[model samples]
Target: MSLEKKDEHDHEGWMEERDLTAVEERYLAILMWLDKRLRLVDYLELLEDMYYKVNLQMPKSHTEQYGLDNKFWYWYPLYALGSFSTLAYLIAAVSGALLGFYYAPAAAASAGDPTVAYTSVTSIMVDLNFGYMLRSIHRWSAQVMTAAVFLHMLRVYFTGAYKEPRELNWIIGIVLISMTMVFGYTGYLLPWNQLSYWAGQIGVEMALSIPLAGEWVAQLMFGGFTLTQATLQRMYILHVFFLPFLVTALIAVHIGIVWMQGIAEPH
Candidate 1:
């Protein structure tokens, strides 16, 4: 190999070809100097390669397989339920995160009249600026998500979209629906108002009715077969922390499967 002086290489000629501004010239000069020392561009290319390699590959739908000529295959209204539920889930997540800043999970106030949890809810609804709207949005989004998920399941069932290779997603859908119900229930109990209190009591009783692990389920879930500070804490944790991660993961899988199977052509 011939010994070559790198200073003989003409980077200025390369820059001159593009007619860069003074600012761009300085930026490129600094970048080139740093890149010569640290090889940043090589690392960036590696990252870009990895990104493209790992990118999701969505499956083609029936319409795409044949042609855009098959417009009848891509019905918008009923097929939109999946996307609608996803949108509602996003709305609930954002509003719930904002509501979390002001929420306390204690079951009772110092005076023991209204529970601390209930007081916090009242404060969010009545005192904090735009808190009512924030909470309303959260509540409504959750409700809408639930309704949309249920309707989506019904749509899939009636259309026989759950058959053949789609059975796994159908099972996952059942789990997601159950998790959604639990999400709502946990959030419902967080307020610790009279209705919530009775609701928790009912939950305890229902858990205790399970044959084998009845008492264990009651203790684990309801905090010793009775509603208390622990109950509220548990509910808050499940609602804000556990269920979010679980539901979000299931949602990602559900969407991924749909992307693969392409919304099971209407039967």
Candidate 2:
């Protein structure tokens, strides 16, 4: 028997035998080189198998499975409300990030006057280029997201889509809705205008109205009893950093669970 290994199974030889084009030959050569050293082909084959298996097991759409044609549904628009809300959230996040670049949380510079934070917002809206439009887009998107989320909840409730297997998703939806409101409320205070100031005041009052830990909640959230620099800073951080991360993670998990559970069909 020969001590040297045979080159009969050489990938280059195989490519030549198959009469591959120049590009295909180069691609195959590199792929074979990588596969020989890394055994990537086996993993790729496993992934492909899994992909096909998942596709095969995927559930058919209700209309397609039931062969229901020409059956226009009234609630079909409501079905898309969740997706619309998600889109709005994404828009708000992007615009809010851009707005954050121009906004200042300092309220000390003009203490008796409007406030540094308020002035910063005025500058953004009136002085900076396209800043007004950016803020408008962010505000509108946030409003739209809140509205969509509310409607989505109502749709889910009336449709009885929160039964049995979907109860966890329903709870997740509720959490997301609450987070969405928080996101809006926090962002609303970043401007530090009269409206923003009063809203923050109301928030403090609401927190203080809670039973035993009311004062603690107010302190933790608003950073004391008054809407001072601390309050603006806290709101800015919540709007631009904390709530964004938390809400985004929760939204992703909520959507992922919904995807896995599949859309509930009307009976």
Candidate 3:
């Protein structure tokens, strides 16, 4: 017999001698077959090592340290606000991307007539299948994220999580909340309806109210001081391109800090 045949024969005999269940035999056979081709065992061992290294460094909460049996969700709802807001932001981003495929940003219209932007939004709400539900999901998710982020800040403040080594993260959180509001405001103007038009006008006024960089801010954001096609285009670009990238990067940094520092348990 060849050496390979001898090894295979020995493997079969070993399995038979174990008195294993039928399921166990099948599972071992499959595992050995794949391990021969994939070297999965080496990767598994590496992952196990990494798990232990990371697990050892993480700080235990007071409940965990004291062997208390209290569940986190039932005992401490505020601890979850950060995660909840992140979930809402992700939902809004996905729904908004889907809606983008059908939305028009054109605002060309004569006086008292609906622009192409408004008409496209109306079509989505009334004509397209499941469009209303999709829009509702995006809108509601944005609102929920806003509320959750606000409450998260309040929780951090009340818990003193913003003190000491966390002051930098607190500043980042403030920036995140401001950017969240800007995200909602920019999306709100995409429809170019009467409400959106007025909202854009108000944004223009607010931008122009700045002392040193008023006109520059207004021009950069709303495009030349009027709620025209340029304004809608700028808003669409910011909503789709600029804000998403910036906010996503900020969120990654924020989460990285939290991972390094561990959750700040309230006193």
For TM-score, the strongest prediction is 2
Write down the lDDT of every candidate, Cα atoms only: 0.89, 0.87, 0.89
lDDT of 2 by residue, 116-158 (tens): 8888889999999999999999999999999999999998999
Per-residue lDDT for 84 in model 3? Answer: 94
- Candidate 1 residue-wise lDDT, 185-238, digit = tens: 999898788889999999999999999999999888777888889888888999
Better of 1 and 2 by TM-score: 2
Candidate RMSDs in Å, in order, are 6.2, 4.7, 7.2
Candidate 2, after superposition: displacement of residue 213 in Å?
Answer: 1.4
lDDT for residue 141 in candidate 2, whole number 0-100: 96
Ranking by TM-score: 2, 3, 1
Residue lDDT tens for model 3, 77-106: 788899999999999999999999889899
Which candidate number would show the highest lDDT if scored against the true structure? 3
In model 1, what is the error at residue 221, expressed in angstroms?
A: 1.0
Q: List candidate 1 stretches off by more than 4 Å.
A: 1-61, 64-74
Cα deviation at 40, candidate 2, in Å, is 8.3
Return the lDDT, model 1, position 244: 97
The number of residue pairs in model 2 that clash at the backbone is: 0
Candidate 1 Cα RMSD after full superposition onto the native fold (Å):
6.2
Model 1 lDDT at residue 44: 93
Ranking by lDDT: 3, 1, 2
